[model samples]
Target chain A: MARILIIDDEEQLRDLLKQMLSRDGHEVVTAFDGVDGMRVFNQFNPELVITDIIMPNKDGIEVITELLCRNPNVAIIAISGGRRAITAEFNLESAEMLGVKGILSKPFTRDQLREAVQHALGL
Target chain B: MAIKTKNIIDFKSEAGRILLTSMGALLLLMVSAVFLSSYLETQLGSFKEVVFLGLAMVIALGAQWFLLKTIQSPQVLSPEERVHTTNEKLRHILNSITRQVESALGIKNTAVGGIENPADMLAATLIQCVAIMSEQVQSLLSALQMGSNESLEEARQSFIPLIDKTAETITQYLHVSQNIDNQLRERINETQQLLLNLRRELATVPQNQQQDTSQLFACIRQMGDVLETHLLIDNVVKKQLEVVTHDTNDSAFTLITLMRDLSDQAGNLVRYITETISKINAMENGVDESVGYIVRIGHFIQDIPEKIQRDIQAIQSASGVIDSLSYLVDSIKEISFQTDILAVNAAIQAAHAGDAGLGFKIVADEVRKLAVNSNKAAEMIEAGLDTARHTIHEGLKFKFLEEVMQQMNEAAQMMDSVKKLQEGHEDMRQYYKTLFTVINQSNMKLAQDISEILGSIQYQDIVRQRIERMQAAMQRRNELLQEFAIQLDVTSGNNMDDFATALNAVLNGYLEEESYHGNSLNSSDDGDQPPKFELF
Candidate 1:
């Protein structure tokens, strides 16, 4: 089992992801945004991180950059439900350009999440 | 040897000696009586009878004394010798009786080797010994009836050993039986304690099971609540998607219509500018022709005064041409004004299109500026026409052909301004074409964005399906837990096989559903594509 951190402004999606990952025997922690996520990341020292792109305080790109700076090998999976003129593809592509371990569009399935997590963790 | 001889009589030897002595004395008496009888028959017969009777009495007395002395010799044993002899006899009788009892009971070998259920064996041996004793007692009674003192004494001594042996056997049997009884009681007590412990352990099973069942029920309730929340979230997301989809579709349609209108307006404005350019070119040609005629008129007046009237008619014709050119300029000005109005309307429509029409709006502004420039050129041409018309009428009224020559210069300048206006109109036409292209590209991008938005809306349905699957699994789990709870309440038996089976079935069902849904979600169905994921 791996320790994972999830950062997202959507409470429902965060909780849902937590439940799904927890069922897979992983220890999961959640944060409301990138700011809280970073704080939790330091304290939790998780093996993997799953974050949403668009959020209130801080966004996924900033979080990915900061985490990569701290530990370049840290596994990160970026997820996004694009807003306004921005598409999820664009958001994910941007995160991918930053060298994230994995990317997923919003409303992803459990299997998809599991596969991404496996890929990120190199399992 | 002495004690044995003293205590026991030699009855056979003594009886033989006594019989021999009695017979010999009787024979002696008989002989005396016969001799005397024979002599007396001759001399004294009565004296012979008296001598025979006296000799027989003497023989009987001698026999009695000899038998008494022989029997009395053994009867004189010492008291100590008698007791020792009796004890020895008793011991011999006891040993013989014990051997008989052991042989009868088949216990001699068993006693040496040891036996199971010794108490039972001892009791059976004691019973058999008593039977032997009974036979001995019957023999003793027969011996007493026969008046045999020696046999009676031997029977009495044997009976004592038999009675004592039976009593000892019974006591040993009792001791063995008591030992067996105590062992049995200890085992019974141990068994009772074991049963009490088992009962106590069993008593706690129901309580512990009840607690576990309650915990299971609570978990089931929690799952139910989560399912309900998922359902609510699904509904809300779906409704929100519907609203967003509707609004996006309406906006897209409105934007498309507005773009179409703007494109048509741009096309119309380009066409108008083309026509206005042609009109301005034709009017410029007319102005140049009029200038040519006026110059010729100046030359005619210089050459001959007699041709002045002819030149006057020429000047009049040129003035009429100038009048028509003024009308053409006015028409061009009107077209320019119409183009300006169209540009302003296109700009308003572009503004309504928001961000997508920003380029279109810029082009519209350019078009409006061109229209304003066209109007300024039209006013310049009309003013030039007025100058030509005023110069022609002055030349005709004053009869001075020099003023008409100056009218030619002003007309040439007006022709240059008209040519410039025609060039400006040409530039406006190209700008309008570029604007149309910009608008077309913007509209295409907008349509694509709208399609993407429609595709993104499918995420809601996907989420709803996932939630529904979870709800189904939760419902099944709850049902199984309820059945387990009922089973617990119904029976106190620790039969958990049924509950375990049911629980496994529920878990398997949930896992199967999840796998099926996962596969379905990953599978492509027509235009329904799986979610995009990437490992970078």
Candidate 2:
């Protein structure tokens, strides 16, 4: 299994994702927000990153941009639960414009996560 | 007196008087000549008469000549008369020249238009100067006439001031002419300045127009650059969107396939769990039956020790009977000793009577043989009785019945433990059954959730398509705007129809897309309706 990173503001989601990916036999790292995520990303250097679009410090778009600048071929999957005015579609489309590997809306299932991850990693 | 006569002498009247006198003289001469001619004819003949007629003709000619001279010839008068006559002629000539000058200057003709140019103004000024000189000359002539009646010194005194006044008028005219020339020069300078200002204004107009034209062209070029940038951005966005759509579609398909497989697996697991539960129930029943059989077997074995004890008591009672039989065998042995003694006494009596009692001896011997046989039978019977009693006693000595009873109680306790273990197994089976049910329910819920997630994925794709359509419409709008900008001209009025048409097309496209999606531009609420996804 590929090394994966899960970044989200929600504690439960992060833990749940970490558990799921770990169960799937992937080495998983967790972060609370985009800022911490980037720090963790730099240190972990995971093969794939699953990041939430809207976050406290650095948003998913900025993270994607920075990561792409560092490594253009880095695998990225954007997820969003949609905030007040910004819908998940808008955020995901924005991520798509930045050339993300995959995107998932909020309330996605484990299977969907696995599918997106697999697809992103070209598995 | 000569002046008065000259004034009274009319030339026509003098000519008529001279003709009358000539005629009268001729008549008189003709009469005398007629008389002379008669006398000559009577005395000296017609020659003397012709001579007298000739004399009369000469006298008539002289009279006519004298009258013509008195009537036509200027009369010689005094010097004052000559001065007055010359003064009248000069005054008349001066008045005529002034009138001619006034007429030339249009002073006499009020109908003539005024001077229009500097030349005409100069001419008018000069004519005024001439008129002043003529007036001065007229005054000089008047002064000369007036002085004719006075002394020559008086005439000189009057004439000097009048000449000086005439010279002053000529000087004033010259000065006025010079001032008019100066004013004409100033007007020419003013006109030249006006022309220069007009030329400067005319020259500035084209430069301002050129600047404005250059600015307009720059604005057009800037607009073109803006349009080009917009087009470039549109193309890039279009390409990126295509890639996103393609990736999303593939992910969706893959997700759907995974869902199907998971659903099948879940169904199979539920089926397997149900089958396992059924098998466990059957096994539980079998276990219950085995427990019941063990309980019955335990009850049956529960009394084996007591039964063994009773059988051991019966064997002990049989051992007492063997003891009684041993006592009877001792009484028989005593009888055998007594019989042997009797046989020996009979045998001694039979020997004393030997020949005479051969029969008696034979009976005694036979009795002795019988006693011996009886003694041996008794010994054998006693020995058998003793052995039977000892064996019975030994068999009752060990506690075999207590041991069998202990083993039977232990078996009964083991049956109870088996029953409890079966009860625990039933509880464990129930717990496993509940766990399987929870697992099955969770699997179903998981399937439902996955289906919902798939729906959301489809929604994402739909939103993407809508956005793509919007991008396409915006691109078309930019293209139309560029076309409009290119066609825009300030000289000619704008072709608003093209703009309106293009805008309408864009709006119609939006409306069509919205309608196709079963949405309305006026509606803001989408409710909970799931978004439909199209692969394309």
Candidate 3:
């Protein structure tokens, strides 16, 4: 089982991802935003990370960049909800450019999450 | 030429025209005084004529001073210059209006930058514009009051339409701005309602999501537990089936063995009963034979008395015959004795008649000899018959035959008792056969009941599968609830960074578009964006 981290400004989504990944038999950690996610990331040292774009303090792009800088081999899955300024597609593309391994839109299904996690963990 | 020049000068100066008119009147008075002086020298003295002349000069000097003083008052500007000066002042007021309008637009932009509601800023801008216009109107009115030239009055009269036009324009502007303000207020109110609804929904979302997530976790845990329990039950049931099957096999073996033993016993009993019945039948047949022989012997023994009785009767008849014969023989002997006597007499008589008497004596002697023979035979017969009759009487007694008959009756009674004993053995054998059949039927029923119980153990597996399916369905429902909460978060716009970024982008776009139009109306460039809308 892979150890996974979930980061999002939405607490409900964070908890949901954590629960879903945990149910797949992976160890899961959660954070509310980018800053908190970084703290939890260092503390947990998870093999995989799932993050949401357009968060407070720092967004998914910065979080991915920082995580990659710390551990070049760390895996990342980026999720985004479209806002007026940035579309979900744009955010996802940006995260991809920053070396995120996977991307998902808001309101994704359990199957989508599982597939994305599996890809991120190379499982 | 001088008159025309003087006329032109008089036309340019009201004071100069008044002075000429007063000089012409004074000259007419002097000519009239000269004529009046000759007439007055005749009527009155020279002193009266000199006083009239002095009064006329005083009148002319006073008229000149009054005309000069009236011309020197400061209301004497030219009509063209007054119109020029009034036009310049009107331009100043128009410039002030333009500046105020620009300032109002500037204030509007700056206020919009700080405020979320654009209507509030617009209203403030309109108020400032009105105030600036009011101050400029007051300044224009005071400047108009300081100079009262007749040309300025004409200029002021012409400027009335321009002020009315400015007032009309301001009124129209205020009216339009107020309408925009009202529209913006209504839109803002609607937006507030939408935001409030969103906030309320968002406020409840976390708690609801937490509860649903908890339930989901619990369901997953329950599903795990159910899986474990199902596996355990399966294992247990499998093991139980093996044990039960093994036990059933053993029991079946035992049952078959017992059935075999019972069958063997039943067969043995049936054979034994058949053999015993056959033996008893044989014994019964022997008893029947004995009974038949005893019956025959009884009948024969019963006939022996009758045969003895008949033999006695025959012997009696023989004795009777012998008695009769003895009697006859007695008679013969008597007769013979008598005949011998007679013959003796006859012979004596015959000596008397010797020859005739000789025949009679022969006859008598022959008769006497025959009679003697007859009496001797009769005596012999009577003695033989007496001996036979005594032997027959001794043999006629049935006492020994009666003892033989009693012995034959006892043998028949013994045969009947043996027949009863054989019947009792046959009845006992039938009773044992019926008991064996009942025991065999009961064993078969017990075996069937055990087999039925072993078949019913699969129901537990069915129950386990139903539980597992229910847990799986609940897990799916939990996942759906989680997705619903995520969607709620996305739509709520609770993340301020994203919300603000979206607002900025939208407002900038709106302002850029508006600025394109604003430059045409106000002759000013606007680059800064403002807040687009505000809600609760």
What is the C-alpha DockQ of each candidate? 0.02, 0.02, 0.01
Q: Pairs clashing in candidate 3?
A: none
Candidate 3: fraction of native contacts reproduced: 0.00
> Which ranges in model 1 have alpha carbons more than 4 Å from their true place?
A1-123, B1-407, B493-503, B519-536
Model 2 C-alpha lDDT per residue in residues B360-478, reported as the tens digit of each score: 87887887788788778878887777777666666555456556567768777776768765665754444353334334444444545455544534544454455556556655655
**Cα TM-score per model:** 0.22, 0.28, 0.29
Each candidate's B-chain TM-score, in sequence, is: 0.25, 0.32, 0.34
Q: Write the per-residue lDDT of candidate 3 for residues A10-92, one digit (tens) a residue.
A: 88888888888878899998889989999998889888999987777777777887787677679999998855323576566
lDDT of 2: 0.57
RMSD list, candidates in order: 48.9, 49.6, 48.5
Summarize candidate 1's per-residue lDDT along A1-123 as a digit string, tens digits: 899999999999999999999999999999999899999998999999999987766777778877876776999999997653345765675566455899999888999999999999999
Better of 2 and 3 by lDDT: 2
TM for candidate 2 is 0.28
lDDT of each: 0.58, 0.57, 0.51
Q: Candidate 2, which segments miss by more than 4 Å at Cα?
A: A1-123, B1-407, B478-496, B518-536
Expressed as tens digits, the lDDT of each residue in B1-536 for candidate 1 is: 22234224446666767776677666666766665666667465567656665666566566656655654543455756544544443333323322332232232134212223464366356546645654554565465445454565566566566656755665665465444434434433433433343333234233423343444333333433332332332233233233323333333344334333333333333343344345445645655665566566566547655556677889989988988888888888888898899899989999999999899999999988988998999899989988988988886778655656665775676666566555555434433333333334333433454344333333323433443454454455445444444443443212434544454565456557645655232232322343532111
Task: Give the worst 10-residue stretch by lDDT in candidate 1 chain A.
Answer: A82-91
Cα lDDT over the full model 1:
0.58
